[model samples]
Target: MHQPNYIILQCYGYEAVFLECAYALMSLSRLYKPEELTNTEIWVYTDKPEWFDRFADCPLPLHFRKMDAALIKQWRGDIDFVHRIKIELLLDFTETRTGNILYADTDMVFLQKLDDVWNGLAPGELYMHMQEGKISEKGNPLFRKLDTFLRSGKAIKTEGTPLYDLYMWNAGILGFHSSHRELLQKALEYTDSEHPKFPKHIIEQFAFSIQFGSKGNIKSALPYALHYWNMKELRQIIASFLQYFDGKPWADLVRYSSLLQPYILVTEKNMFLQNRSFTEKVLNKKWVPAMPNWELLEKQI
Candidate 1:
């Protein structure tokens, strides 16, 4: 048997995140054949593994690993830096694991076959979700805050030059092989030392960009996946869908229901204002009471 590629995710506190995991897994089932799916493993690191018990019968192989919340709190210092766990997990995989690893946020859906994306990745390469424009002191809002931190001597400087010259990336999805251990270690080092200087929410991405942005190996997976990180309204919709149809097979849900379709349509429209408006419209139209008739909704799809 071929060595399996790992799909990693971290979720805690929010029970609803498990639903996101189910949706992501459903998307994966839609894209991959049974053999390909069998070769892939989904590992979720969470503080509450018991919540995942309900999904024991899911088609995909799911592994739930407990998170060390105490250690996470210590690493975060005074602030609740939950995202720091991502760097720690990446370090663990790169140091201890032997195969290719892909870490994706739960708020994503696979749109197509990922073989091309996986095949495109080379050893020692790190793939990010997408790239934003260059960081600039005069034009960007966050850079001004970063500039102050740099001037204060608290922030550890990158190997060469300041962050203003480097590009920014969305850290929603990251892919790497075990050969990139040193690169992941550097990112962790920056996270440990410079997190206070950067905004807590985005510090991890900044650390990753500082180390890998200049490298030509950084690639984007935007084509194979759709990330709904900014769509708060859509997240609520998904949460509702999952709760309404709890315990049902994801493969059936993906094939028979239109729950995931709205997300694709909104993304295709690509208008922020229009998307928000449509999200609100859907929320109002699809709003259900405490007990929803999921069968009726399923049949409607």
Candidate 2:
């Protein structure tokens, strides 16, 4: 059976970010058996390759690509263009490789078998994290920055496309087949050009939204994975757990940590708070129970 290729990016000197990457890999190891992931290739693009040396014994076969600091600096310029690297890395990966590619952020955790999700991907389709809402030059909080870009002439409006018709999607988890290389290429081109127009934080995601208008075949990956982007408090808790098991083997670390049940619980609670509807909150009053074995997690180390 053929397996899909997975790519993750971690650049510069954020130690917490690096720990997140390790924890993500550990989650992958915990979710799938060895034979299930046997032929799958996992690549990490990073400027600080040595930081990943500690994960040398990772159960999953890992490949490390050292990023060019000068090129990154030139592409990023003065603005905080950290997310732009994701576009560059995706373009680089799709150039030489073929077939299903799954690109994920470091803060995501896999909760179930993704074989069905991988199998469902078809050629000429692009899957994104989640569709936020339609884009707008006014009224919408997210796209007001894009409106500024349009007003400044930094971004060009596509012919026949109204600003409100273009939908914005989160870029945390992206899945595309080799046949849709041009889709990613278009995103890279926009990132290299009108990056200044986008808000420094969501430039890559906004650029992707522009390239992938309503016409783009965008699917959702929310059922298979959990994205903990911007959940700082939960991230700190997970970091503490990773630090406790700093030098342990990946298999042993995952086995002893109860497969990151506590981390998953915390993440779910945070997500529920952010996404729960008013009716759900009122009627579905039952809250997710807190992890009972916090002391056990610490004692295992």
lDDT of each: 0.69, 0.68
Instruction: Quote each prediction's TM-score.
Output: 0.81, 0.79
lDDT of 2 by residue, 64-171 (tens): 877777867755646548777777777777788777777888877776777766675543456777877765635465577665666565565676765545777888
Name model 2 segments beyond 4 Å from true: 1-4, 77-80, 137-140, 147-154, 256-294, 298-301
Who wins the lDDT comparison? 1
What lDDT is obtained when candidate 1 is compared to the true structure? Answer: 0.69
TM-score, predicted candidate 2 vs. hidden true structure: 0.79
List RMSD in Å for every model shown.
4.8, 5.6
**Candidate 2, overall lDDT?**
0.68
Distance from true location, Cα of 47 in model 2, Å: 2.0
Best by TM-score: 1
